[model samples]
Every structure is written in structure tokens, then in C-alpha cells.
Target: MCVYVVDDDPRICRLLARLVGLEGFEVHTFEKAAMFLENLTRLKFGHVILDIDMPEHNGLDVLDHILHQKPYWPVIIISGSTAMDDAITAFRRGAIHFLRKPFRRDDLRAVLSEARKVGVKRIAAYELQARVMQVKLTGRETQVLDAMAGGLQSKMIAWKLGLSIRTVDMHRSNILAKLSARNSSQAVAIARGLGLTQ
Candidate 1:
């Protein structure tokens, strides 16, 4: 995966590029947020390491831009100063984590690991929403599939939905056919993979 480093400090940028690269990531360093936004579309994979202090446009503004554009792209905020307000703002703006400058490599690694896990879930949810639209699943069918996604058996689903087992089975079959899944497990697999289930 790629890692985009947005920091005005040349030394910090180079250091991060080298360190992240050593960890097997394709690294891209940007001196400013505008440049990153200009080429945001081409940045298709992985997360971003953003410095909270920058000239002209602050890191919070950049974070807002990123959130407005592609909300799924995980961002880790790094700052030289220990401003609790900034850290709080970053988190509220959807930053995965806020790291104080001169952070340890291990800490950064842990944050990245968590961010990637979140990114995968976001992607799955997005895919599931798209598939729901494409398949034209009714609200009732969606509820049944959601129950199945939670590993509920048809009879339980029927009871929960106040329907007959036969109706539940019919809904399950329709869900499987619409999703192009052969069996309950396959349908549930799609649901799980697409993050339809909690």
C-alpha cells in the first residue's frame, strides 16, 4: 500500500518517507496540502500521514477537505506541539489517531494497523451499499438478509420478523439469488465481506 506524507518540514518528511518505506510501503511525500488535494484521485490505495502544522492552510482544513472528498481514506495526524485542542479536533474530524511529533516507530505501526482495519470495514460497507442498490433489495428483504448476516437461522428470523418460516425461507432464497450466492453460507459470506453484519 501507499503512504502519503504531508509535512512542510523537509527533514521530517524525508525521515517519514524513509521510515515508512523501510516498512514495505510505497511512500509519497508532499510539502503542502493543496498539492495532495490536486492529486488526491491518483492516490487510490492506503492511508495518509498528515502534519497538523502547515503554512497558509492548517492541517485541520486539510483534514476537512479529505473528509469532504473521500471519507474512507484514513488519516493519521502528527504534530510537533502537544495541543489537546488540535488532537481533539483531529479525532472529531475522523482522524484515525493523533500522534505527537517525534513519535516512536512502534506507535506509528500500531496506529497504521488499526487504521487499515478501519479502512477495510469502511470499504466493505461502501461496497455493500452499492450492491444493495444494484440488486434492488426491498426493505423487508434487506431486514431478512441482515438477520442472516448476523448468523440467525431462518426460523429465528421468521419469529423476529413476525413471519412464517416459509416466508423467511423465500426471502432467504431471493437474497441468495439476487446476490448470486448458492447457499446460506455464501450469502452470509457476501454480507460479512461487505460489512452488512456487525
Candidate 2:
């Protein structure tokens, strides 16, 4: 599996790169978020080992960036702060593991192994939850979401429901905004996780 090692600490970065490389996996290391972002799409990476703190862009920012584009890339954050709020924030951003610094190698490997097993391309949990909490739909939105879950388009949903395409589009927008989800996929992920959609 392809793994990205992003850290500001040179020694730590090198050590991780060496270790990950030795596992017969492809490893890419970056000292800054800008560097990582620059070449982010060069390959399809499986997991990211990110530091929670950096001079400019922290792990959260990078996490958002990844989700914005590469929505399926699971992250394992390495935090030296160990602040509860920080860990919570990182978890909210969909990180699989928030490991404190000075952690063992096996700890990181475990996180990576889990991420590789649970690859999400169709949905994310947080966006689904936000969608559920925000929408005030009385079965209509639920119906729309069910069709969406089946990969139906607005016109298709409208055709099936005997409603105009414009109405379906409006419902779609409301679903996106109400759930605070940035996109349809995110909304679906969150909605499904919340059990708002069957």
C-alpha cells in the first residue's frame, strides 16, 4: 500500500520513511503541507501519517484538503500536544488514529492496517450525521436520499416521483446545506451513518 509520511521533524520523517520503505511499501515524505499538497495526486495513496502541529498548515487543514479532493484517504495523526480538544478535533476530521508523539512503531502500523481494510469512497460518517441533524424532511428527503444511495440522478428521482427536475434539485440543495455537507457524497455518508436513510 502507498503511504504518505508528512512531518516537520527531519529525524522523525526519515526514520518513518525508512521503516515504511523497508516494509516493501511505497513511501513519500514531506516536511510541509504545501509540499504534500503539491504532489498529492501523483498516485493513489492508501493512508497518511500526519503530524498535528506544523508551522503553517496543521493536520486539520490537510485533513480537510484531503477530504475535499481525496475523500477516501484515511489519516493517522501524530500529536505531541495530547490535548483532549485537539484529539477530538482531529477525530472529527475523520482521522482513524490520533497517536501521541513518542509512540511505538506498532501503534502506527495498526492504524495503517485498519485504514487499509476500511476504504470509504461512497460515504463518510460526519457528513452523514450533519445531514441528518439539519434536514427537516418528512419522508421526501428520505426518499430522495434512498434514490441517491442507489446512484440515481436528480432527473431520475424526479421522473420516478412524478416531480419536476427543478423541485428535485431544490431538495438536493437543501439536503446538502441542512446537513452541513459540502457535497452529495458527504451528505450520503453522514446520512447513512445516522440511519436517516435505509
Candidate with maximal lDDT: 1
RMSD to native, candidate 2: 9.9
- Give the runs in model 1 whose Cα sits over 4 Å from its true position: 138-177, 183-198
Reference-based TM-score, model 2: 0.59
Q: What's the TM for model 1?
A: 0.73
What are the per-residue Cα lDDT tens digits for candidate 1 across 80-138? Answer: 88779999999999998999989999998888788778889887767677886677677
* Model 1: ten consecutive residues of lowest lDDT: 189-198
Best by TM-score: 1
At residue 126, candidate 1 shows an lDDT of 74
Candidate 2, poorest ten consecutive residues by summed lDDT: 119-128
- The lDDT of each candidate is 0.86, 0.79
